[model samples]
Target: MAQVLPPLLDYEQSYPCPVCRQGQLDRLILMDAFSCNVCHHIFSVNLSQQSICLADRTPALGWRWARQRWRPLHHPDIDFPLGIWILCGGLTVLPPTILWVMHYIFPPLPDSSANSFPLLWIGVVGITHSLIALWILAEFYQLPLYLSWKFRLQS
Candidate 1:
């Protein structure tokens, strides 16, 4: 006997796979779920007024696929561009070089220059540079995190 197959979704009716991000998502209509053709993962759709997430709680397999890799759900490794480190390195060195050159040209007298070049300047440079680095890293790492969480669903 030939097993009956359900209807397949068309291109427009399908969506990008939430897990692989590379496959098309086709509806498993009879089950009220969705399946990814590429990775063959299943999802339980949860639509609510406040929030809509696939899987809707702890995933059964406890794994997530993102950035072309599979990792543990809660602690997925984030993928970031190499450019973030390059930019951060330049920013880190430029400020200190400028400060050092200025200090070298005008040698602060040991006893009387504390007021002119206060310790507060050091604090300012440190805080500003750290803030920039932290912000860049945060921005670079966020996308991967979002992807991992979004695809965590398992039906």
Candidate 2:
């Protein structure tokens, strides 16, 4: 999938932010520490166990880094009404495919050349519908939805 934006937080490297307590402590330009986008406070990283606030660091330990893996995290936006993603994907794929199949399987009769106009119209409509669905999917992808390696951290 094409990623349009970098995430606010890198899950493999961050945890629930201690400073803001809303967003995660996202990794900063430096690898050893993180900064919360919410509070704008930078904190140190404790790679051994959990999110720990060192004496000198800002945000300290709460959720620990226990497990991590990379997968497509569903977008919170379109997920509403649920199964919408599947529906969009289906619409993107199914129409053109069906039209192609029907064209091959049900060719126009030998003397029905003038009647093929409707088939052309259907093909154009299918292509337009497919492009619309694809555009919708692209918008979802561009909406900051990302695949992350999330850790099952404990509080």
Cα lDDT tens digits, model 2, 38-139, are 556665555554333433443333333333311222231233634657878788678777877787798777788566765786778777887787667655
Q: Which lDDT tens digits does candidate 1 get at residues 26-138?
A: 66767656678856777654322111135634545344433233344454565446778888877776786677677777767878848556445755786788788867876
User: What TM-score, to 2 decimals, does candidate 1 have?
Assistant: 0.39
After superposition, candidate 2 runs with Cα above 4 Å error: 1-89, 142-155
| Ten-residue region with minimum lDDT total, candidate 2 | 146-155
| Clashing pairs in model 2, backbone N/Cα/C closer than 3 A | 51-61, 52-61, 53-60, 53-61, 67-151, 69-149
* Strongest candidate by lDDT: 1
Which parts of model 1 are misplaced by more than 4 Å?
1-80, 113-119, 143-155
How far residue 44's Cα lies from its native spot in candidate 1, in Å, is: 23
Clashes of 2: 6
